[model samples]
Target: MPKPLFGMAVAFGLLLVILLTAMGSFALFDRLDPPPLDKLSDLSVEVIDRDGALLRAYTNKAGQWRLGIDLDQIDPEFIEILLTYEDKRFSSHGGIDARAILRASWQLLSNGRIISGASTISMQLARLLEPRQKRTFKAKFWQMLRALQLEARMSKREILTAYLTLAPYGGNLEGIRAASLAYFAKEPKELSLGEAALLVALPQSPEARRPDIAPRRALAARNKVLERMATAGIMPQSEVMRATSKPLAAVRHAMPQLAAHASDRLTRENPGALVLETNLDRALQEKMEAVLRDASSKLAADLSVALILADGKSGEILAEVGSPDYLSVARAGWIDMTRRQRSPGSALKPFIYGLAFEEGLIREQTRITDSPVDFGGYQPKNFDMGYQGDVTIRDALLMSLNVPAVALLDAVGPARLMERLKRANVSVTMPEGSDVGLAIGLGGLGITLRDLTQLYTGFVNGGYVKTLRDSPAEASALAQATSNMGAPILDRDAIWHITNILKDAAPPQGAAKMAIAYKTGTSYGYRDAWSVGFDGRYVIGVWVGKADNSAVPGITGRSAAAPILYDAFARSGLTLAPFAKPPLGVQEQDFADLPPTLKQFKLAGLWASPSPVPEEAPRISYPPDGARIELSRTALGRQMPLIVKLQNGRPPFRWLGNGRVFAANGRRRSISWTPDGQGQSTLTVIDAAGRADSVSVFLQMPPSAP
Candidate 1:
């Protein structure tokens, strides 16, 4: 019995010693001295340029921020309102207020659960200072202890300031300043009474308080704060009532969120940078976001969109929308779909034309037959379903005809065109035997908005492809713009001509002036819609489609994406920089004799009809040259012949013209042929010596005119 009692006594003594030691150690370490402001976390700030002005702010990985209000743009009333409702003893307390804590503790104990919060401004600041952790009881105790220590070390004003600067309001928005600007479209200091109250109510529940989500709840919370302020005598009762009666109107403005993303991206791309200077106009940025949001909501198809604005001269990205939502669920822990890959649709046509121009396979006015063509089981058709017999390269591209482009592609060879696109950073891996035709011209390759923007730079910057740079200074410092500095990929003249045609392709709609050149691309099955265009100084590309590549039923680029571009330009106030100047040593020509390929199919009227020979009775006046050519006369019978006058030439020259297969038999040059149609055809005369001339002679029907 005595031993058991002694054992109990020893255990009690050990427990007492341990308790005393822990209490002493905590007392010694818990009262922390205040830290200097300079010792605060390494916070960074981003100042964005917008519409000839600056929008200064900062963001975290979660996209939270502190606006420029604490620098005093925010009203003192807002700060006062928040302190009164959130922490009545903000001025008198350090990091923790004992009275509030006790009251909260009593309420929790009495109710058998916690329904009330008693975090002082200082305690909130302590939470902000530390990394995010679970809200466990132990963590709360640590937080409270730390708050007390912070109070012992810092002044009341310092704690309050830190709390105001670091509090998380919602999304990536932190602190009163950021919340004010993001919601009110004004500085915190510029907030009215009702606006101030609305902001004070958000920290408790950001989404619930978000004007976009719950305006009535937000208004009720604002009124609650106003009533508290009036009861505390901080504001007059009449003033509180007036503010309460006024609607709470703090809508989450979309522009700053987009700017934040752009600013953050620019900063990350160029770290340790003094300033992330960009060409983005803030007003324009806001306008673009607004237009996209409105348009997205109204669109019949359930889809998201991505828009990129760049400086045509410098290749600097002015603005970009990675996702529609400020805090998009799809963007979490995944590649930004805006930066992800999408089928380029017809957005790639200009570059294909650029390749043709470079290869000298087609010229602006080269004539091409706009007829149905089938190559090794491959076929292509026009969008209109009716092909133009003949058109110019400029007309075909402007009108976006498919048959002509396919014809040109076949002539120029797809292998060469693929190589050119690869050089432009476009990945074209269509299998080797696939008939490369106008199908390629209509955007059959996968592409990204960034890649498309870069390719367009050649058009805007005098046929020179330059790497995208982060800043204007770097772009300005690039070597003098030259044509094909790496290799001659495109003819300087061709780029010049193509840019001109695209620039005048269509009239600008809405308030936007037709000061830029652009193209619309629609993918097969209506899966992707794109509009890429450029003013003198900037290039803008927009894409709208589903993440799953599902067809939009009947939407096209011209119908959807073009309107977005027009809206952006009008809202951003973008003006024409200047016309793309032509390069030196580049001459304009009639493009005569250029082959009928995808890029040159528009020029198809140059070949004239061939003279036909009357049956076996027809006579020839000169020695025949060996060659095949289309004759103006059409055969109406099984055997048709016409008179031919061929100049002296060698044998074995194939006369290929007028869509017929013809060859020289001997000195007569006239050969009997079965005709598909009895009309004039394009004629050509060739000799083995490769020097034969011909005349257009009429061929009489063989006693039958069917």
Candidate 2:
């Protein structure tokens, strides 16, 4: 009774089975035949140089290798290990492994989700070459089909070679060959079994297998690769055991002959130039690195350092260290601190003095009172808690006096100074106060190594400000907005004068003083130490501080950072040349007779003064022989006939005040003082030689009883 019905049901079931099979085939074919992708190894790297040497490379995009050697020189063991771990049958099979596919499919069906990957070496290469595509089953199938197609088109060895040379290992290292040289500092052909194992483990997870950094994890992965190689009969079992058991050899690191800074420039010029010629002086770079490491050790382990050495005239960065460990392969290590910004201590004073000289607030010979200057509630103390009633701007700069710089900042206008800094590409954030900007004037602002170095260029380059460029081409390409105002901040004569003072004021003995003009900077609480200077040839800057953003106890720029600069110059074997002649308008003065105010106040030997000698008081005015500073009183104090006087070391001196003049001998001079109780004061002076000098000190006194 149901034979016909049973037959119809059977036919229907068979038709359903046929339909399902056709659908499955369509899915498989779709997955295995996806569209081809464009090449993915797109990168542009920057390389920097000094004279004509290869320094280092930095990539603006991915797939850039910064190794100092050729890829072909890499060790063969690394390739073996990579193939053994990433694709065991790389030499025996096509790109797609049927066994692997079956196993993965079974696992996925049982788990109800894709739980494992069956990607062959070719497939992996395809993924790397076209990483922009989606990662779905369809995408994976297409990758497999493409890999198989590639296998048909190319030999197994050819595919493997491409994979080994094109894969990204880690930070800027794009191939196993480059990675081998970078991690071990040796040719790839020279890698040991243990070293090969480590490199092999990296392709699975570059960060995870960073033997130079995470040795324990790298060792474990390397052991696994060795075990696999042994199991596959690629190596003898005894050899595998020995390789797995032996301690990983310490990899030799490349002593990059190029300055790390040069890398930034090279990457911008050529996108795929793996081997770059740089301008770094290898000797100078090594010395700089040594000094930075040593200086940081004196502080906390977390302390960091950054530096840049440039040609003063050419603005070429001879050496640059962005951090203590620029090549650190660790997952967690010291960050590049040089490019980052932090507070600058006394290093910024030169710019202040330069501006003061330009404004005519104080001449090099004018008397500057080194007293405890009170700016509203803010009081600036000296390095030594002392004061000299009288000091010239040149002497103040030589000693790095805080009061005078603050005084000059108040007079020249902090806003103007900030404008100057901004023009130099340094972004400075001012603080709060009637003298808010004064604090920053003494380097209470945050600045980066690049910007700080550029700031000093003004003094070296005829007082004109400019921006920093990775190369001359980049500089020339800058838009008007990016370029600085080329106007002179200080007269060329003024800059020349200040440079001479700085040269004389250099620490009695230091590393860079032999061939450079420099200034040191220390942050509050000694958190950061910086030294920046220039000679006729180059400009250099260095900074040392804590990596964890904590203070480096007692490490001042003069103490810790300047030595690095000195060491670099010494190692580079560069000559220190005399700065060029200053443009005219710089006059000379004799620092002799003491002013009556200094004598009356008994400021000599006072602890609050920037005394010429530790125990002696400072004598001179705003600008010393070659220094410059702005001079103005804090507030409009009672109007008084302020006396201005100048005396040579030899003889007669004359005091000038209120348009009148008086005479004096070599020792000391006194002038009449008349107070009108107003807030303005002016003084004039003429030495026996008839050299005229004038100064105005604004004094704002406490209000009388209301």
Candidate number achieving the greatest lDDT relative to the actual structure: 1
Question: Tens digit of lDDT per residue, candidate 1, span 1-706?
Answer: 6754555555456445533554455566664534334314434355556342444445544454653223354577777788889888877765556567556655555566886787877767777777456987666666666776777777775676677677666777777766766787666667899888877887778777777678788888888888889899999999888888886664677434445555666666777553456666666666666766655644533466777777766666677665455554432312344566666776767766776677676667665566555544455655533345577777778867776666566656666767666665444444357555545666665667766776777777766655454345445433323313555346678788788778777642323347788998888877888888887677888887776677864456765677777777766777768876777765455664343343333423432233433322222232233323322211111121333443334444456446455654443233333334544444565655556444332333322111
**Local distance difference test, per candidate?**
0.62, 0.61
Top-scoring candidate (TM-score): 1
Q: What is the Å distance of residue 540 in model 1 from its true position?
A: 2.0
| TM-score to true structure, per model | 0.54, 0.52
Count residue pairs with overlapping backbones in model 1. 57
Assess the local accuracy of residue 432 in candidate 2 as a C-alpha lDDT between 0 and 100: 41
Regions more than 4 Å wrong, model 1: 1-163, 166-174, 189-256, 259-281, 322-337, 426-439, 466-491, 508-513, 584-706
lDDT of 2 by residue, 324-423 (tens): 6555433012355656678888988887888877765555666777776556545787654435557787778887878878877777778888777766
